[model samples]
Target: MGTTLHPLNPSDANLIQARLSELGYYRYQPEGIWGLVSRSALQDFKAANGLSADDVWDGSVEASLRQARPTPASDTPFGEWSVVGFACSAEMNPRKMVVSAKGIVVGSMICDMQGPLARSSADWSGSVLCHIDGRDIASKISLRVSGQRLVDRSVIGTSTIVPTSFDRCS
Candidate 1:
């Protein structure tokens, strides 16, 4: 049988983003999506490497990136979190995480990550208090994640004694 090749999946976004960010080109947190920032970073990489500024990522782009180095600011440690990493289940903006919980965690488990965007954890004894993206969480006390639209009725940064169901991905 011949060797099989696979297409880029959602999980692959962070890996590529990590590499690019390490190279000092990608300037945003590696969420599992190829957005404008990622494209811009790729373009910058191409330009700096004397490659044509086109959308198509051929063999040469991959080759150049593989030979590149990473930056020091890729990540900082998540103190006392001796658990598996996680990703935001939100389809659009997937936040990276290093979380410990009382029960099951939805979404893919990412490795060596800690999101300053949000902190989801079980704050009390047998109580799962989930924290999602901190981008707008500070202003909003709760969320209404409905029908995969968004994780709903999520209360963060408060002593809201609740269960894991309140969290979309925990």
Candidate 2:
């Protein structure tokens, strides 16, 4: 079987919203709703990228969006983050993650779903997937890296993990 995408799902919408927000298209929080705002942003993005401004999130549109992500500066999520949080079945806690531009030096094992940061945004956000037993599990992980803080949210299976926020450690 192939991967199926449900555009209406909040998790899926969150991913789309994060990508759009990173690309300078969407301006509001990624609340995961297919409203006029989201449609307008998608249309604007399509028009700018030489695609028909239909506001439809299909395979073609997704492919285009994936290609439009900004490259990361380095292959790691390092430097001092102002805020950081982690959530799992057993425990949820606020923690400090120490990583570098090269890769993860300390803290939870995390990396960008995309390789590097080719583009930057004011309120940039991205998605991360959890790998268990060498398989990509069906979990929703989102990260928002802003001026001095980073917010991480992980939803596993059908359980919602409360979002964890972190600030860049000075």
**What are the Cα lDDT values of the candidates?**
0.39, 0.52
Model 2 superposed RMSD (Cα)? 16.0
**Candidate 2 per-residue lDDT over residues 1-170, each given as its tens digit:** 12245558878888888887776566678988868777766765664454664667777778777883533212113344434343222232225554322222124444433322222443332343444445554444445565556665545546676776766553
Q: Which stretches in model 1 have alpha-carbon errors above 4 Å? A: 1-8, 68-170
TM-score for all predictions? 0.36, 0.38
Q: Candidate 1's error at 23, in angstroms?
A: 1.1
Which 10 residues in a row give candidate 1 its minimum summed lDDT? 74-83
Q: On residues 2-81, what C-alpha lDDT tens digit does candidate 1 reach at each position?
A: 21211144576677678777765666678878777676566545544546544446676676666634212212111111
Stretch of 10 with least lDDT, candidate 2: 70-79
